[model samples]
Structure formats: structure tokens, C-alpha cells
Target: MLFSFIQSHDQNHIALRSNDHEITYGALLRQIDDYCARLTDVDVLGLALDNTIEWLLWDLAALKTETVCVPIPPFFTRQQIDHTIARAGITHMLSPAGLQATGQSASPTIPRGTAKITFTSGTTGTPKGVCLPASAMENVAHSIHTMLGNDFAGTHVCVLPLAILLENVAGVYSGLVAGCTIVLPQLGDFDANYSSLHHHLKQNAATSAIMVPELMRALLLQVIKQGPLPDLKFLAIGGSRVDPHLIKQARNLGLPVYEGYGLSECASVVSMNVPGHDRIGTTGSLLPHVQASITDGEIVIHHPGFLGYLGETAPGHHLTGDLGHMDEDGFVHVTGRCKNVLITSMGRNISPEWPESVLLAQPGIYQTIVYGDGDPHLSALIVPTGPHADVSACIASANETLPDYARIKHFRIVAPFTVENECLTGTGRPRRKNILQQYLSPLAVKETPMNFYDQLVAQTAIARAELYRVPQLVDGLQGRISRPTYIAYLTEAYHHVKHTVPFLMAMGSRLPDEKRWLHKAIIEYLDEEEGHEEWILNDIAAAGGDKDAARKAAPNLETQVMVAYNYDYITRKNPVGFLGMVFMLESTSTQIASMGADAVMNGLDLPKSAFTYLFSHGSLDIEHMKFFEKTVNQITDPADQAAIIEVATNTFRLFANLFGAIPHVSEVRDVA
Candidate 1:
């Protein structure tokens, strides 16, 4: 059916574009025929390539031959890749390098009529294969093309990975069905560099593109920075719930933006918003190919074009697991996931996405996940826009729009969830289980019961390992040293230490009213840190290095960035976060400062005066850590704890860079 649409189009019309290469319908069809001929003996084909002309050709060829095509997402971990190969019983694999045999020829028992298997990396580490039929996929594509009409039948740029079902069926297949030229840019070329991506789109005169909310946000920002793409007629945003305000913002700026909803089980798109029949808050009207109704507050799709899982029997109907409803105008309004709905202790059920979307609409709040399944009130883990974000005010403003029970009572400022951390799905949805395991306790009802100090210690263990792994720190611990390298370390240390008192003073002055108790500790820190830079200069002088030169030397780029980060972190972010730097410095001093001093001194035969700063800090920080731990234990606010943890994590990373930038013993020897 898809091939017929392609074949019926003008044979000379450009069908695919990647970089500078273009393939007309005639050439595309010929290439697909050649690919189909080669796949005659193959039972299952694993397609693993970036967005390119060849990827589309191979995909269409697989569809033509009725081969069980498995599109492997590049972002899948090695374990996931291996699992997919074995689970799909893949016989041949096609990657950027070339097609190769996987050595496995066993035919897996998938659902009958399955033409393609797309893996969805859900809330877990492992990805599950969703078996789809060619007819079902074609139906969805045809419906999308029909709904979008001829206005969208122009250049359609592929903004997302072709491996994703949403981009595959709704974007590429639908564009082909509409006889639109498909532009296949390398996913990485524009994934992070939105400016280049928008430029590519403008250069191609792209009229339509499919994007997730995250990508849409980036592109919108880019458009604001540069200017709107004049040729763009349709931009469909999906993969996760989008803030309606974002859609409104895009339209107000004259960028055509629409929100849609779909899942892997439905062959990608079940409903969408188009140009004339547009609605802001809803997921838009249902597509012509699928029928949806609310059953038991869960969206149920009848004959949803789904075949079944790889090994499971096909169900009569698909229970979408998404809770939503169709309004009088036939638009679908998705509330949230049925399983993700939180039942408070008072028995009031609330969807976390409700307050979460509201929170996200605020200026400073970037990403948030709300939780309080069996607790009295809701809490959230929020990733602020930047260090200067006033998250308190943002949360307060978001609360004004939500019911009291669903209002966020407590929130922790944390790092952004990423696919690398396995805390977020590839589609930008938070893996609630993984996030809760990493941030909250196992039960997911409340914050971890551990004290703030203990939690900090537990959370930063991996970062500490990374810090310890720096070559300089490792070699220094093992007694590998040079006199010049030691002096270089002292030079950088002097530069950063000079700012210690100022950082403390700034932190003390910026403490919020509720954290007034921390002011005394900050004052004590200021007094202890006042002359620490002079000690490093004295150590430099005793070590036979020019103390005056060391005192006036500029800090290395890494050291300068670290100092700037701390200052910015103290002034812009939560002042309490500065304790993270103290925790890192003092705790590290107590652990390794004395031992490293002894190793360097004995190895280089330096005088005891040369070790004054290290020796004093080694012993002095022990009592300081005791005081620090006691003070941090008194902090019960979730936001404060989150700030400290985030800063400590960043401090460990930046400090590692600082140590890494120091002149290594081997480098100095080579230089000499």
C-alpha cells in the first residue's frame, strides 16, 4: 500500500534528501527493489542506521518484502542492543558500516502478520519489542497524510531518529504517502545544535517536521534567537506531554506548532492537532485510522492497529494505560498515566503530570517529577533552568493554579534526567521508578529517610570515585611526583583558596530567612578560611619556588572555571549549596591531604615548612568535618539538601578537571 502511494506519485519528484544527495521516486523505487531482491532469503532484518536516504530505502524494501524489520535505536545500551538482536531472532543486521550476518538464523515466534518490530525503552533498562503489521503502519501513515492535506506535502525534514516509531510512521511514511520530499539529516548534526538544524530546515524549505517536546523547546529558543523559519507549515510535537503554554508561545511567535499523542502499541500516532482543526490543551482529534474511548478512566483503543508483543498473544483491544477523555468537540485530553496516578493518604487521586505540567509552565522550572503516593502532601524533584533560577517563586506561582492536595509542598533542586543516567526514557519522559530509586526512597512515597549529611555522602560516592581516579591524584597517592608538578599544584590551589572567605561571606549574606541557623557556621568558615591562601604561598616559598610569582600567577582555566562556578553557585543558586564545596574540600583534605603531603615531601625531600598548608588542613579539617556534618544534619529542607547534593556532584567533577589540568610529572619531564 505504501509502495503504491510512492509509485503513483510523479516519478521525477524528489523523494528523499540527505546532506547533498537527492533521490527521486524513480531512483528510490529502483534502490528499494534492489534491496528487496537481496533480502529474499533473510527472515528477519535488523536496521541500525542514522537518519539517511539509505535508511528509508532499506525500510521501504523490508516493508515491500514483508520481512520482519527491527529498527534499532542508536541510544540503546550495549546490553539492550545484544538483547534486541537475540530477542528478535535477527538473521541480518544493517548498520552504517554495511549489512552483516548476526550468525543467528532461528525464526522467532512473533505474532502472525508482524512486518516490523520497534523496541520501546520504557521505564526500565530493557527495551520491549512492539510487533507491528505493514497494513497497520500504512493505515496510520495514510490517515496522517489525509488529515494534514496537501499543505503539508512539501519538504519534510526528519528532526528525530528514524528508529523511533513516531518519526518512522508518522513523519517519514506519512510524508512519503503525501508525496512530500523527505529530508534525512544525520540525527546528531542537529540534535544538540538547533541553530544548524533550523538552518538546514530553512535551506531545504522544510514545511513540516516531527519533534518531541524537548526538541521543540530547543528549536523554539533557536527561532527566538535567530528568526522563525518562514517556510515551516506544520511542526508536530509529541513523544511526551507538552506544556500547552509552550505550544501557545510558539504559535504567538508565528511558528506553526501542534501537539499530538501516540504510543508504540498504536503504530505511533493515534491522535494529533492539525492547522485548521486546532486545540491547545488537548492531544487533538483522533486520526481517521483509529477509534478511542474512555473505559474505566483509561483510554482504550479498539483495533488500534496493534498486532501484539513479540511472544504474546494479540489482545482484542489495546488498553492504552493512559487516562484521558474525549470532549464534546472530539478532542482527546490526556490526564496522565493510569498507573502513575498518586493516591494520597486522604484517598484523593491525583495525576502527577497535572501539577508537573503546571510547574513546567513556570519560568525557572525546567523539569519536574511530583510524588507523594501515600503521603499527606506532594513533593517534587525539580531541575531548575539555571543557577540563577528562583525556583521558590516558580513553585509558589505554579501552586496558585493547582488544587491544594496536588500542590507541591516540598521540592528538591536536582540535575536534569538524561538517557545516560537511565533516569529518563529516550523520549524525554522520566522513568519514575528509576528516578525514585535514585532520588527518593524505594517506596516512592516520600523523600529518603536518611539524614541530609548521610544522603550527601551516599549520593556523591560515584563522583568521589571519579575525582579519585584523576591521574594526578592517583599518581600523587602512589608517590609519583616531581618538584615542578608540586609547585604547579600549589599555584592553582593558591588562586582558588583566596576566594574562600568571599564565597563564605556571600553565602552567609544570601541565606534565606528559614536558613538563618546556618549563618553562624558560615561565619566560622570565613574565619578559618581567611588566610588559607597565604599558607599556600608560604608552602611555595619553603619548597624553593618563587612565592611572589606564585601569589601573582593567574589560575589555570580549570581552576578559574571552578572558582567562577562556586561564586555563581553561591550567589545565583541556593546559598546552602556552597556547603557542598566545603564538604568536598574539607572531607578530601582529611582523607588524602596529609598522606599526599608526606608522599611528596619524602619523595622530593622537601622541608616540613613546605607541607604546612597540607599538614594543617589534613588535621584541621577532621574537626571541621565533625562540625560540618553536625551542621548539615540540621538541614531538613528538601530544597537545601538537593542543592548541596547537586553542587557537591558538580564540585567533584570540576575539581577532577582542575587536578587533571595540573602539569603531570611525565609531562614536565618530557618538556624538560
Candidate 2:
């Protein structure tokens, strides 16, 4: 599709616009042709430009010449840019010039420049350049045309800075492939919220525009304000992480929304949700001819034709840092990220994000992060609900009934979470290590045992033990608190939960009889989580609220390790992979709702509203679960049904202990 656009339009229609000036495809082609004629050796040069026509010209030229191009955001400072460029061994630099880095300096040395470097956003430190080949840029253009086909032809506008790979590939290069009129709005001028973006979209009869999560959010906000754009054909939202609620809300608002997966390494697209065949959770099925899979729960792309690295001649397949599953239907659904996986010391593979969502759902916790992979226990960072609210107390309360491992062991109270000013990524995912560096340092610097919260509970348990032991029995409770008792308490709690299981499955949810067996199994194993307070409080109170007695409870994370290579296999990933995940999560939602309700009603005393009070799965994840279903319903891929079953089974195992197992505490402990 894109090839046809390029081949036919040495002249014909408009190709790009920046602010006021409009350039024809013929003219645009001529500029690229000229650049190509000028610098043939500048195969893999760097592309760093704001959302501008010049950037488009260079990008198209690079693609046309088959140069492996490295496109970086204009916002990256000199240090970042230089690090990438030097690593990639790029020979050229292209922009209108004056690209600012924090340290004001420029390498004004080469005409055969445009030094391209595919920098790893860096899992550890010192971001390394993946170093794409100069001529590989065109492969992405080829990939897009092969998948979406050449039918797309209309006005496509720029809503993002041109440097982003998604915006560059789909927004600009794709448009050029279709020979569409490119509309460039004024810099920094967006629709009042998203309404204005929609207005401009309608005004120009925009068929497509590239988007990031933030842009999609702004567009949704605009849709709410100004209503939906009627003519939008494809609104590709990618880059960074995207939430399904946001997608569904946009769909409800009447946007022709579809999502896909791609990486800077893969020329911006690995899979996408087409208009009719869209799936919510899985990135749309692999684009025509692209191959994707989940190998041991990690995403691997096999594009027989992949881009080469910065100036390097070596070639290989692209393996991603993302962890995902391929359903029976073949669509790919990303789960937790492999790079960011938070494995507890107990070997329980927990997606901290899974719990983080629950915490964030609470209005009280503006920002909450759970971290303790490989540590003895889980801990968290919470932005306070309010000035006066005690964060430690909140943490304690939240974890009161939680099993030992998943419970937060320590925490920091950082209020008013701010991503800007370099605390977070442009995409808002925590710079986890950075977060550790900032908050964790305070404890050591103060020269206090970072055991402040730990001691608080310890002291409370001691006091409680004393109270329980009062000889006069002044409303006193008596018992010796010990770790085994807390464990026993957890055990008893689980036992009391027997009837809760069957009742919830029967009373709640919309599952069929055959699938109801899952509910039955869930119910049977649910005793472990019952009467958690008794387990925690019993140990503390037995010691007369003695902190020392409370401290006797040995802490350990849930250590259940099971490698799911069967479903998590990297080779079988297809659209089915996506559908499989969708179905799996839905099944779990049904089970969780049933078990959660039982836990609450049987004896937990939790509020009915707490289930969906925007603080837990009842609140945010319910939407996530739903979107997976909806995405599946939209899919035409035959692999979907099978994918559903595969993902569901995997989901079951991943959460088996957390959901199905019961709690057991051997002793009563003080209120820490």
C-alpha cells in the first residue's frame, strides 16, 4: 500500500505540512531524492526533529533508500543523544539544527550525518544503543503496507512529535505510502483538550493519526468535551502502556479506535487491532506477514525481514523485554513485562502491577508501588490519601488479612506523585531503581534502622500482649502469642470459608454450569484467606499487645514457582494468544468475584461496595477483564476460542495459590 503511494507520487498530491507550508508528494519525494543523491554513504543517520515537514522528508528518504534509521525524540538532551549516537556509530545528524540537550553543545562536523542509534531505554544503567542498520527503515514501511494493505487513502495529520517511531512510521511514512494529504497543525496547538484535536481532525477530514497513551487520553477528553469525530477511520494508539478502560471509553465515545503492538526496534508495529478485527487486550493480530509469539512468557518477533542495527552489518531477530501470552487463536496479549517482573522470594511470580492497580484504584492512594521481588516480603510506596492520613497505618490496614508474602513489609510515604522534573519516565512508568534510590536513601541517611514501621508493630504487639495478660481481667483477652498461632489463625480462617465458596458461585456471576466447576474448585480452596484479622490480631493480642511477641511471626513471601512453558511457549503465539488471555482473565474475574464475595460475606466483614469501589479489582480491573472479552468478540481470527482456553488455564495457575488457597495464622498479634 505504502509502496504504491511512493511509486505513483513523484509529484501528484500533498505529502506533508508543517505549520503553514504545504508540500506536495512530488516535492517531498524530490527533497528525499535530493538528500539521497547528496549523501548515499549516510545510510544509517540519526533523525531528531520536532513534528515537522523536514523530519518527514528525511524519514521518507531514509526508508526509500532502505537505510536503517534511528529516530529519537527531540526532547532527549545532548548526553542522551550523544550516548546513543556514539554507541550506534552514526555518521550524520539531521534536524533544522539547534536541538538542545541539557548541556548546550552541538557536533557540527558532518554533512553525511543523521547518526541513528536505537538506544535501549536501559533496563539497568547507561542506556545502550541497539544500533540499527542504516537501510532497515524501509523494512518497516514494507511491513505496514503488507499488513494494513494499500487501501488507506485520505488526510492524515500529525498529533505527535515526528521523532517517535509510531508517529513517524504510521503517521508520516504510512501516509506517504498512501499518497495522502498530510496536515500539520501549528506547533503546541492542540484542540482545547481533545475537542480541538477532534475539531482539527474533522476540519481536515483526517482518516488517521498516530497516538501515544497521553495523546489517546487527551483525545478521549476531547471526545467527552467536543464529541467524536465522524470521519476518523483509524486512530492508532501506541507507544508506552495503554489501558483498556481508556480504549473502551473512546469506543463508547464513538472513536474508530484500534490498538497494536510494535517497538522502536520493529519499525513501530508488530501487531494492530484493525477496524473490524480489533481485540481489546491483545495488540491487534500480527499485521499481514509478521510473526509473533510468547516464548516462555516473553514476546519474540520473527519478521523474516527485520531491521539491522545502527551502522552494524550483523542481523538477527528482535527479542523484546515484554512478557506476553499467545492465545489459541494466535493474537498476542502482553501480560507483565519480563524486564519488570517482581518475583517474590517465595518464587511466587507476582505482577506487582496487578496489586498496584488495586492500590491506585483507591482515591486515597494517589500513587502506590509494590516492590519486593526476591526480597523476604513485599513492600510498597504510597502517595498519601490526604495530609492527615497515616500512610503506615493505611498500609497495615490494607495488608491486615493478606497472606504473609503478599503483605507489604515496609513502605515510604511520598506524597503528591509527580512524574515531571525527572521523577518518572515520559510515559509515567516508575523508574523503579530510581524510585528506590530516592526514597530508600532517606532511611540510611537518617542512620535509623529502616525498621521504623516494623518496630511500630512490634511495640504495639508487646503492649497488646501485656493487656491480654492483665491479671484483674479488666476487659482483658488472654493467650500466649506466637508465630504458629498466627499461622493457625490463618488456617482457621481458611476453614471457616468453606460454605462461602459454593454460595458465591451459585449466587453471583454469569458463568455457565460447565465452567461453574472452576467456581467450585475456587470455593473449596478458599479457606486459606478467611478470618485474617484473627490470625494477625490473635498473635498480637496473645502477647498482651507486646511488640516483641508480634515480631516473633516469621515473615516469608509466598514461594510457589511453576514455569508454564506449555501455554507460555514463544512459538505458538498468534491471534489465539491474545484471545486466550482475554478469555482467561474473564474466567478469573468470575472466580475472583465469587470468592471475594464469599470472603467478605462468610466472615471477613468487608463492605459490599469495596469490591468495586475503584480501589480493587471490583473497581479498575473489572474493566480490564471486560475489555479482553470485548476485544475477543470483535476478532475474526479463528484462533480466538482456543486462545481463550489456553490463557484461562495459565491465569488459573498464576493466581492459584493467591486465589484458591486459604490463610492460616497460628497466633494473635498486636495492632502494629
What TM-score does each of the candidates earn? 0.66, 0.54
In lDDT terms, how accurate is model 1?
0.83
At residue 330, candidate 1 shows an lDDT of: 99
How well is each residue in 1-672 modelled by candidate 1, as lDDT tens digits?
Answer: 888899999999999988879999988889999989989888889998988888888888889989889999878888999999999899999997899999987455687788999999888888898899998899999999889898779989998889998989999999989999999888778644355766777778888999877677667655544444778899998877776766765775457988899988889999999989989999999999788789988999998777888788778889989999999999999989988999999999998888888777664677888999999999999888666355665676677667898888787777788888888887678899888778775544443244567668757766775786677876565345688888999999999889889888888889878888888888888888889899999999999999999987788999999999999988888989999999999877765674577766766778999988888988699889889989999888889899998999899899999999998863221210
Winning candidate number (lDDT): 1
lDDT of 2 at 69: 59
- Give one digit per residue, the lDDT tens place, for model 2 in 1-672: 454556686585777766678877667656878766645766446776666776666666665675545676654656777776666545566666732222212223221323244454543334544433333345565666556665666778887666655666666666666667788775457632343776677678788887765556656644443434667778887754454644764665557778777776665677787765777866778766567766777888775343344444334566787877777877778666676678876788776755564444232355666788788787787776455333543454445435666677676676444444445553344677777677767463321232322222222322222221222111111122233332332333233222233323332243445444344433432442234334334434432344343334432222122122322332345323423433333333443343333332223223333223112333434555444434445434344344544544553443343322324332222311
Q: lDDT per prediction?
A: 0.83, 0.52
Alpha carbon lDDT of residue 251, candidate 2?
Answer: 69
What lDDT would candidate 2 get against the real structure?
Answer: 0.52
Model 2 root mean square deviation, Cα atoms: 21.5
When summed lDDT is taken over every stretch of 10 residues in candidate 1, the lowest stretch is: 663-672
